[model samples]
Target: MKLEQVSETTWAIVDASTYGNVGCIKLPKSVIVIDTGMTPPLAKKFRKLIHKEVGEPITDVILTHYHSDHVFGTQVFQDCTLIASSAMAAIYPELLNNRWSPEGIQELKEYYVQNDPAFAEQLKDLRIITPTQTFEDSMTLGKENEVHIQHTGGHTAGHSTVYLNTERVLFAGDLVFCQQYPYAGDQTNNPLEWMRAFEEILKMPVEIIVPGHGPLCGKEEIQIQLAYFKKLETWIKAQLSEEISLEKVLQTVDSSPTPPYDLKADPRLKFSIERWYTFYSQDEG
Candidate 1:
């Protein structure tokens, strides 16, 4: 876990030891945290770090999406005003009653216990904290409204990006994966919306970008992701025209594209391909 001062007013945990990056925007009297870490303990430690480093009381926490990696640690900010997109907030009830329920959490812990015992330990006393405030499309925070958060569904239906108008920094939460293959297997992931989100980010005068994961970057990275997704869309459509079985299509396009990205061994590669294949298949049907 490394904390980097992205700008005069913004700081980010770019190299998360667990998963998902976290960021905060320091205001005159308060600080607004962008997504907590992957677990309760991690977020608790991060909250303490923010208070010590930023020297301001945390007033609000903005959730970029509903993924466990980005949201499960929200319990640390229960005292603050937790905010999320309306689409994201709506899913919390179902997630709480189902995937985040005690039984569901135990099942998750059991799975992790086999794979990552340390992480499973972190989930021991985990608690689910839902957003207290919701936004429709876009909203602004800060005394001068310098913080702009907009819902740009792509990676997930409720995914959003936070931009600092004055600092020229963009906190691209999972919308931009710096160097690795993104997890596009989410049920709500949409290639088209993802591309549009990239386009929207390009339009901003962003000097720095704090991606949801990986090192800090700029618009160049966004362009690369956009181009990659466009190529993926084209390839998927071409494959569909052949009317071949989905299995055959997957087998034929097993190799990852190179010029832009070479994430052939990335675990999410095949999963993303399959999800995109299913999405296009259903659309064409």
Candidate 2:
């Protein structure tokens, strides 16, 4: 909910510990939103803040990926042009029909209400909103390379990262988890490609980075994240030779090849290990 102005035209909600970082950029005539918050109420609050403080109506909302935390709040911005990767757009129907269906959303509300009764009313009338615009590779907004959106899949098949050409600020989405552990278990994720994306990022002259779920950082944090994944891949490859059950593999990984990064209380170590194990196991098989 806290906003920090990164540059003259860029501002970010740096409180990813509370929710995914939402941001807005000033264009020639209007503002472009980076990612909406995880829920309707949160998104509404962000929309109102942009208008109140930024003094510009949101003309476009560029989603980094299709993760519910990033895209689920798009309904509030239905009036704006919603943009995403073609891969993310392709999965919208399935997400709407199953994962983000009204029934599925209601179930989530019920689970949260069990812990906090006041959450029930806040989740009312929640619905999925798919992107209206999509691109296969890269897209530019405004003139002279001010804003650039490029499809960079590693976190997910359709994930995209935004780059501000003039400022050298990259909105890395889930590709860079900053100081925290990243979720690496999605069926669409490509860990090797994700690592390659890191190398590409290092090559860039990004002065500031806005990660999907962490604080504002620089290239060193990206290096740490890359190192973490490499260590994970090495552990998975080492275990691929063992003729053990998946559960046993999980247990063994849980105990050894200690993760190279700082683990939050809810670290994705088991999930990352399982995902890499499955990926490598298929190759070995």
Candidate 3:
């Protein structure tokens, strides 16, 4: 993992060997973490690093969503106030009883062991720590209200973004995938809401964006992602008009117009396309 200073009071832990990206905002008396790393060990190390670099107690850990990559590491911050959108918080019980159950976790570790033994080992003592506090639409933090967390509902029904009011920086969970295609295959993913979220971000005074993945970027990346979603929506609408089957549409998506980003072979391409196609199909039906 690498830490890059974003602004006067903001910093991001980018290029994590794992998938998710996490960040922090330095406040007067304490620090607020954006998202925890992908695992307990990673988050433990991150906690230490934050203390060493910022020299302040971590008072709050704000989660952008309930994805394991972003919230799995939250175990290390159990002592702090863990926060998330009410919609996200509502999913915890189901996730805990199902995917995050001991049996389910064992299955996940076994699956990862074949591909990444190191990460699997880290999951040996894995535990799911749900948020203690929840917010409906938006919440403000800091004595001066410097941090603002808002529900955007795009990548997932409970997805959100954290904005540093004074810094003009946005911690855009999975909403903006900097240089690569995003994973939009979540069952609750909504292309229309995602597009609206992008439009809202574009109107912000944001000068810097800490994406859920990839290196730090700016509003240009948001514009690219928004345009890509618009293009995909247009294509899906045309296919629906022609009465194309969802399966056939997925098969032919590869031949559709190329995205603006150069990573055409991104593994997430097909997953995103399938989900968006399904969403549009159901809507049209």
Model 1 root mean square deviation, Cα atoms:
1.6
Which 10 successive residues of model 1 have the least lDDT summed? 252-261
Backbone steric clashes in candidate 1, count: 0
Off by over 4 Å in 2: 264-267
Indicate whether candidate 1 or candidate 2 has the larger lDDT.
Answer: 1
Itemize residue pairs with steric clashes in candidate 2: none
What is each predicted model's overall lDDT from 0 to 1? Answer: 0.86, 0.80, 0.86
**Residue range 1-285, candidate 1, lDDT tens digits:** 666788998999988653899999999998999999899999988887887888678999999999898988998889999989999898888888999888999999999999999889999888888899999999999888999999998898889999999989999999988887777988878888888888877887999999998899989998988888887888877777878777886676654364246776676777787888888988832
The local distance difference test score of model 3 is 0.86
Give the residue spans of candidate 1 off by over 4 A: none
- Tens-place lDDT digits, model 2, residues 1-285: 767788778888878622778888888888999988777888888777777778687898999988877776788999999999998789878876886788777788888788766656656667777889999988999777689998888888889999997888898888977667788878777887788888998999999998888788999998877777777777677777666677888766555555445473445667776777787788832
lDDT of 2 at 179: 69
What's the number of clashes in each of the models?
0, 0, 0
Query: What are the TM-scores, per candidate, against the unseen true structure?
Result: 0.96, 0.93, 0.96
Clashing pairs in 3: none
Q: Residue 109 of model 1: what lDDT?
A: 93
